[model samples]
Target: MGANFISLSLTFAYLAQSFLFDTQVYPDVVQYQLAIEGQNHTIHLEKNRDLIGKDFTETHYTKDGKRVTTSTHE
Candidate 1:
């Protein structure tokens, strides 16, 4: 019984350590569609980007066919 308890304790400790550490889960970027109604704004949850920290909402419409994006804020 003691041997089984020690083994269980060790397994629990290992699992606890693994959960506490910062495992690098793949970083991600998400795009959101902003809906504005007469100065009121509502943010919507969109899809995730394949590349981490990528800007998915870059402006594509312009008089000269130009697209630009500012700094990303979380």
Candidate 2:
């Protein structure tokens, strides 16, 4: 049982590390747009990153569904 536990723990740790590496090394490009009501009301967004690839963009819509806001991380 102890040997099995150690093997399972090692496998889990390796998998987690691999997942983190992939996400950090290969950042995903996300392009999203949304619109509601009116003829020309829309929100268009494209995420941009710096040299280190740490910047991220997030968009949020209000509960009333009348406004949209965007935020960035560094």
Candidate 3:
């Protein structure tokens, strides 16, 4: 059964690699999409770049979320 063992090990290794690179899929965006065990999620977040660090503005009565109207160095 050595062939079966090798196949199973390879499958497990692939899964582990996928998990480690979960954050790699999201770049230059404030949110991420992830799926696990048939459950999915869209996580909201704010990231700092070279130009500005953790800077954002939110206005009042803005029903829309993540609607960036103003930015730094404008």
Candidate 4:
């Protein structure tokens, strides 16, 4: 019974630790713009490092979502 109690306590501790420090490694795009002229344009973005220390992605999509471009500055 003591062993079972210890195991349950360890389980709860592990669960608690997992919940406490969980964070998303994947950064998202914080800013974007779009202009669709009689076509379907969908832009999906992710993170790229900036010199001014702002967190935003350099990825861009154009030509009816058929092209992908990356830039140092948007």
Candidate 5:
């Protein structure tokens, strides 16, 4: 029973460390905004130049009484 408890604790610790420090599992996201013809557009993507001007999906949200717009690459 003691050995099993120790193994379970180690497994949990490994999972916690992976969740806290693994960058690939939680990639960095950047937000960009563009304005054209008096209209505003917002997108969320990685900081890569090659990804610009690609197809994406737009999402809208409301937080703290303000509308938020975000986009994800398709």
Candidate 6:
């Protein structure tokens, strides 16, 4: 019983570590859409090319070629 418990604990720890630290799960661009007040809003997270590493650009836009807001983060 002790051996089985140790084995299970090791397996759980391995899985948790992989899930918490894995970088490959992230992508270059992610997008989401929402409807509020009968208008469509699109939010985007894109990898920034101007920076050296891992920076992101966030942009929000409407359906009719109108930009609502934009921001950048590292």
lDDT of 6 by residue, 1-74 (tens): 33321111111222556667877565556556656555666666676756643455567778998877544442
RMSD of 2: 19.3
Candidate 4 residue-wise lDDT, 2-72, digit = tens: 33221111112124465568574433442233434434444555455553443434556776886665543
Clash number by candidate, in order: 0, 0, 0, 0, 0, 0
- Candidate 2 to truth, TM: 0.21
Which candidate tops lDDT? Answer: 6
Candidate achieving higher TM-score, 4 or 5? 5
Q: Which has the greatest TM-score?
A: 6
Superpose all Cα atoms of candidate 5 onto the true structure and report the RMSD in Å to 1 decimal. 20.5
Ordered by lDDT, highest first, the candidates read 6, 5, 3, 4, 2, 1
Model 4 misplaced regions, further than 4 Å: 1-35, 50-74
Superposition TM-score, candidate 1 onto the true structure: 0.17
Q: What TM-score would every model get versus the actual structure?
A: 0.17, 0.21, 0.24, 0.20, 0.25, 0.31
lDDT of 1 by residue, 1-74 (tens): 33321111111212445556848353232223333332433333333555556444544557887776554542
The TM-score ranking, best first, is 6, 5, 3, 2, 4, 1
Candidate 1, number of clashes = 0
Q: Give the lowest summed-lDDT range of ten residues in model 1.
A: 4-13
Instruction: Judging by lDDT, tell me the better candidate of 5 and 6.
Output: 6
Candidate models: Cα lDDT each? 0.40, 0.41, 0.47, 0.43, 0.50, 0.53
Query: Deviation in angstroms for 53 in model 1?
Result: 7.7
| Residue pair clashes in candidate 5 | none
Error of 1 at 20 (Å): 43
In candidate 4, position 31 carries an lDDT of 25
After aligning candidate 2 to the native by TM-score, how far in Å is the CA of 12 from where it should be?
Answer: 1.7
Candidate 5 runs further than 4 Å off: 1-27, 47-74
